[model samples]
Target chain A: MTRITRDQLLARLRQEIPETTPWEVADWLRDGKEITLIDIREHEEWVQGHVPGARHVSRGFLELQIEMVQPDREAPIVLYCAGGVRSLLAAHNLQELGYTNVYSMAGGFSAWINAGFEFEEPRFLTPAQRERYARHLIMPDIGEAGQIKLLDSKVLLIGAGGLGSPAALYLAAAGVGTLGIVDFDRVDRTNLQRQILHSESEIGELKVESAIRRLHDLNSDIEIKGHPVALSSENALDILREYDIVLNGSDNFPTRYLVNDACHMLGIPLVDASIFMFEGQVTVYQPANPAKGIEGGPCYRCLYPDPPPPGEVPSCAEAGVFGVLPGIIGAIQAVEAIKLIVGIGEPLVGRLLMYDALDQSFRTLNVQRDPNCPLCGDNPTVTELIDYEQFCGLPPRS
Target chain B: MSTIYIPTPLRRLTNKQSRVQVEAATVREALQALDEAFPGIGERLLDANGEVKRFINVFVNDDNIHTLQGLDTPLNPNDKISIVPAMAGGTVKA
Candidate 1:
C-alpha cells in the first residue's frame, strides 16, 4: 500500500552512489587512479572485439574473484556492458560490499561506439579478425571509454552452453580484465546448435576447456580462469562471495535457487535471466538494500514464495526451448549485469517481465511482496539457509 | 444456485463430473457446499490454512476472484465458477 512515485523512489536511491562525472572517470582511468574497468559481458562478445586491456571475469565469478580484481577496497572502478543496465546493478552491489568509488559507464558500449571513437581491432586471431571486427572499430558506442570498460573487466561464466555462449563471446571481444569459466559438463552433440562457445572438436571435452580455448583464440590479452567443478551448496556461496555480481545461466531450478539465496546472504546483486522455448526474462535482484532505499527490499523469495514443485514445472530437460531463446535472453542478461556493474540506468526490481516468443509478446507483471513471505515478510521465519533441495522436495544429491 | 466447474485434474475427486450446482450466499459458502458433496476437493483447492493455493487460479464469471475479494468475494445465484491451474506451455527437452 506504500507506493512511492518513480522520481521519489530514485531520489531516495540516489544516496547509495557517490556522485561522479564521466570526465572524472576518464581522469581516473588515465591518471592511474588504480581504477579497474570491468566489462561484465560474456566471452563470445569479447572475441568479436572488445575494449583493449579489459578483463574477462564474468559477473558470476566476480563475486568470488572480486578481491583478485581489486584487492584495494577503495580502488576506483568503472563498469560497462552493451546497453548499460548490468553495470548499474554491479555498481550497487560493489557499494553494498563497502567498496567506494565504483562507477558505471553511461549508455555502456552501445553509446561508446556510437561516439565514433577508435576501437582496438580483435587481436590474436587470423588476418580475418580485421574483417570480422571491422564493424566494431568503426562504431561510436564502443569507443575508447567503453573499450576501457571492457579492457578492465573480468567476467566468469557459469554454464558455457546456450546463454553463456553469446555472453562469453560478447565479453571476450569487448576486451575484459579476465575471463573465467566454471563448468564441468562436457560439450555434447546437442550443444552445437546453441553453445557458440565450443566447436565440433570440443564435443565430449570439458566445457571450461573448450570455452577457454575458443575465447583465447579470439582475444589473447584477457586472462581465462577455468574451474572444472559443478557449483554446489558447499562451494556455491564460497565461490560467489568473492565476485562483485552474479549472472545465472544454469537451467535447473536448484542452481537458480542456490545462487539467489547465496547472493542475498552475501549481499551481492544477481543478474538473472531465463528462457523457456522462444520466451525469455531478465531482471536484476540487488540482494543488498537499494543503496539509500529500504533494506531487505525484495529478494527472489519476494517474487516466488516457494519453489515450484518438482515435475510440476518443466525444465529445459523436459521442455525443449528454442535455439535462439538463450541468445536473446543471455545477451540481455549480460547487458543488465554490465549496467549493474557500471552504475547506469534503472535496474529491474519488484517486477517480472515475461516474454513469449511465439507471439513475440512481452508482459510485465507487478510482483508484490507476500506479507507472510518466509524470507522477506514483515516477520520472516527463514533466517538461515536450509537445504534448498529438501525445501523443493527434490532428491538430495548423494 | 450457481454452476461450479471442475478442472480436469480435480475431476477425479468429483467422480468425473464437469459441472455441478451448489447453493451458497458467497463463493466461500459454495466451496464449502462442494466440499460437502464431494470429498478431498477442498484440500487441493484450498491450502492447509484454508486460503487458496498460490498457483491455482479461480474465476467468478470471467473475472479473477483474487482481483475481486479473494475467498471473501461474493457470489450470486447463477454465477459461473471455473478453476484452472496456472499451467504454462513446454515439455522438458532432456
Candidate 2:
C-alpha cells in the first residue's frame, strides 16, 4: 500500500470539495441564504461553541446523517470542523454520497472565531451525563439537546408509593434535573409488595425520605426534593408551583382532586394514573396554553366531574391490586412526564390509556376538554383550591 | 351488536366478564342492554335522570360519548364501547 502525507491527502480532497471562507458563510447567514451549515466536529469541541445557526452532525455521523440533515442533493450545504481538515474530508465523503453542492468552510471554526464571527455556546453534556444517558443521546428525538432539557427540568410526584416509586426512579435515571416527592406516610412492609422504591429497612421511615434515598442512589446527577407532608389545598399551590410538571400517584379521591385542581390552576401538566385489582388507567391533564394554541387538554374533572362516594369504589388494599399494575402505569407516567419536559412526542394529552393487566391489552380512548367544566371551562368556577376531602364527601382530617 | 368493555369495579356485575357482547343500536341502548344482561349495571352507570354518571365516561370505540352525541350516539355494527370510571387506587395501605 502507498502511504501519503496528511497534507497531500488534504490537498487532494480540497480539489474536489469546494472551499468557502468564514466571511462568505457569515454573509450567507446574515443575508438569510437557504444554506445548510453543519458543524462536523466532535460533541466536546462543538460544545465549546460553534457557528450560530449551524447544525451539529459530527464527522463520525456525517456520512450516515447528512441526507437526513439536507435531503436535497442539489441544495447548498456547508460543513466545518475544528481546523477545516476534517470537514474537507467530510465534504468529499458527502460528494461521494451524491450531495452535489457540499462545501467545506475554509479554515473551519477556528478561522471563524479568529475572524470575529459570533458563535453559539450551548450547554454540553458532561462525560458522566453522556455515559448515563448514552441511549437517549443517540436517539434522533431525544438527542443531546433533549437530554439537556431533561437535566434542566423539574418534576413533582404526588406520592412516593406505588406509582411514584417507579416514576421517580426512572425520572432520576433519565436525568430529570429536579424531583420533588410529596408523601407523609411511612414506608410499611405491605408497601414492599409493589412499591419497589422502599425496602424492609425503609419500613417505618417516611415515604418521602425513603424515596429520596433510593432515587439519589439511582442517580446522583439529579436533585431529589422530599416534601414529607400530605398535600392539601393550603400547601398544594406553593409546593406544586415549583415544578414544571407533576405526576399524580397519590391514592384516595381527596389527593387526586387536590392535585388536579392545583395543576389546572397553575397551568402545569399533570400525568395522572390509577391502578385497581387488574386495571390501570393513565392520562395527562395539560392546562390551557393559548400561546402554544393548545386550548387545554381535558382536566380530571372533565372526565370525572365528581368523585365516587366513600366505599363505592374500593381502595387498592380492599380490592387487592395486581402488584405489578402500577409498575406499567407508573413507567408510562414517567414517559409522559419526560415527554412534557423534553417537549417531544405526542403526550397523553386528551387521551386516556387503559391497561387491563388480566387481558394484557392497552386501549386508548379520547377524552375532550369540557366546555362547561367548572375549573378549566370557559365559564369557570372553583377558582381556588377547595377542601378536596370535603368535596369528595370525606370527613375533614384532624 | 357491539362489544362493551366492563371496568374492574363493574366486572362482578357482568359475571366477571371484562368484555361483554350486547345487542344495541345506540350507546343508551347499549347501557340498557348491559343492565338487562346484568341486573344492576344501569343503576350504577346512570344517574336518577338516567344520565351517564358524571364520574364515569362511556366511549363508542375511541371517542367519548359527550364528544360524539352523548347517549344518543349511534353504535356501529362491530364497534367497541368502553366504560371508564375515575378510580383512585394508586397505593395500597392494607
Worst 10 residues of 2 chain A by lDDT: A310-319
lDDT of 1 by residue, B10-82 (tens): 6567996767899987788888999999977887778789887765656787555655787888888899876
RMSD of each: 17.0, 6.3
Ten-residue segment with the worst summed lDDT in candidate 1 chain A?
A123-132
Clashes of each: 109, 0
* Candidate 2 residue-pair clash tally: 0
lDDT of 1 at A256: 67
Interface RMSD of each: 6.3, 2.8
Which stretches of model 1 miss by more than 4 angstroms? A1-150, A290-297, A369-371, A377-379, B1-94
Docking class of 1: incorrect
Give the per-residue lDDT digits (tens) of candidate 1, residues A147-177. 5565566565667878888888777776665
TM-score, candidate 1, is 0.56
Residue A345 local lDDT, model 1: 65
